[model samples]
Target: MGKKSGKQNKLIPESHFRLTHPSVSPASPIVDTHTHLASTFELYRHKYPAGDYTTVFDFVRGLYVPAGVQDIVDVWCEAPVRPLWREFADSAVTEEGRRDLWGGMGYWFVMGVHPHQASEYTDAVEADILEAMAHPRCVGWGEMGLDYHYDNSPRPVQQEVFARQLRCAVRLGKPLTIHTREAEEDTERILKAEVPKDHKIHIHCFTDSPAFAQRLLDWFPNLYIGITGVITYSTNTDTSTTVRNMFAVPASSPPPRLRIVLETDAPYMVPAPIYADPAFVAPDAKGKKLPICHSGMVPWTAGFVADLLPRGEGEGEGAEGWDAARVMTVARENARAVYGV
Candidate 1:
């Protein structure tokens, strides 16, 4: 994505798309199950240096708060965990701190070394993660799993680090936030071996096959699939297919409770709906896309998923089908279920 122009063309709501459709109730606050707040803020600064928001708190309040985003699980997955994480985590400990720092949004986090940085994983790194796990705002361990697509680290090292992280998370009784891509076999094998069936697991930003998702769902009763803006992309058939398979069950069978949670995975996966919205279109008609994604944009992703749902079946009914509010409600419940945030 190109850097945003220095010229301020529109207000925040117009520049960044918000769900104005009546079907999406503003009362149903958004709960972002996964995102990268620090990285997203840095990108925001780069893209719009002279823009309205300066501090991360201001950025979040200006963009996310107005859109009714209530809770967020920011991810801290890297080697040599950033010291700023402590500041962010510590700031969310008290209600006053949360109100002052995150604009009254519930801010929680997960920490671990991502598989791309697996080769850098060491005892010190693991110890730092363990220390964070004890913090009141730290919710889980991961975004750690195998990634055969990039294989930035040696495959064996990735596997070893993944298993190691899994063991630590499981031993500590923490929820698992997994990141698996193009390595379904190893991910499944390792998870089945290392994790308990009833452990709360979140398969973040799932882009894998429906069969793999079904297998994981069948194996782990407490597991929930993470749906991001990627679901709105035409190329990502697997994510939509997985959602369809989960919700489009036989009518004879009771409608399966949605085992899915919504996330932005911000600074990435800006939903397609934003591009289509006239409000976000450049005045010059350049079709410039939003340079960054954030928690507030999750409603568009929810609307996309709601479109894929079977009509007149699940929660809240609308003429078109399941209301986006219902999608938000279900996803919010699933987030609380899996992460307890």
Candidate 2:
């Protein structure tokens, strides 16, 4: 969650509020390790805050493809609903479109109920998720963990659900994408207790303390940290009284380059307040904010990384120099680590 200020939310740095300029790229393959193209369409249809999902494919074809993003893992978790969704997304592809637009019309899939969908974790749901995993595209086990702020499900039930998913990942030899929020302590405890040896784990949109991050690193050596524009757009109003959130690792004391990944949780966490601005308009938009954040923004996110990186390390590489190239190198390595791509 971000810091709330009077009616206008204070835009967090990770959110990239003032970023209108594009960073220079070095022709590297950057992967949006996490995103939801389908969800963006849905959010826009409902008229959410940044609900202009039209022209997403055109944007990707023109902007992101030229920008160098190779693949976007379209993750899902609801058992009953997602199987149909997967088919729906798949059916839209023409043979040529599949190869050209989607690079094979294939997406890395993650299966496990999110905390919000925890209510669906019944016997039938479990069966459906298991069946989905059998598909060749299923790559990981979740975007699931604990969310204390929105106690959508009881903590115990969330834990049980998480444990079962972890077990499923272990059996399948697939990595896991985790979503941890205020429930960091319990989330960590359950992970420590349930995650098996050789299990691959990625804590997506991590917002815990650095100490907790360190502990997780120690406990799960294979664990990785996902960085997003959220760092720039963090709504944490406490930035005035306290330092930024704990999950952020200064680029100075960098984690292993392989332990980091880049993500754009589009249609949902549009990086900064700039999306709320009028001048930065979305194409084909009807007075609505851009819902599917163009993957081109990853370079802007890298600018924040360059800003945080220690001085004397040629900081020029971020905003002006090799910033895009540098972030892409680490991001691709992270993908390789997580999926052995």
lDDT of 2 at 279: 46
CA RMSD of each candidate after superposition: 3.4, 7.5
Question: Which candidate has the top score in TM-score?
Answer: 1
Off by over 4 Å in 2: 1-27, 45-63, 88-97, 100-106, 237-258, 273-292, 312-322
Which 10-residue window of candidate 2 scores lowest in summed lDDT? Answer: 238-247
Q: For residues 1-341, what per-residue lDDT tens digits would candidate 1 score against the true structure?
A: 13333444422433453344344454677899999999999988876677778898988777787778889999999998889999998988999988887889889999998999999999999999999999999999988998999999999999999999999999999999999999999999999999999999999999999999999998999999999999998899999989888865665865477789999999899888866766655465345667678888888898899888888755422323676788888888889898887
Stretches of model 1 off by over 4 angstroms after superposition:
1-14, 17-27, 250-254, 281-286, 314-321
The best candidate by lDDT is: 1
Each model's backbone clash number: 0, 20
**Using alpha carbons, what is the TM-score of model 1?**
0.91
The superposed Cα distance between candidate 2 and the true structure at residue 291, in angstroms, equals 4.5
Model 2 scores a C-alpha lDDT of 0.62
Residue 137 C-alpha lDDT in model 2 = 62
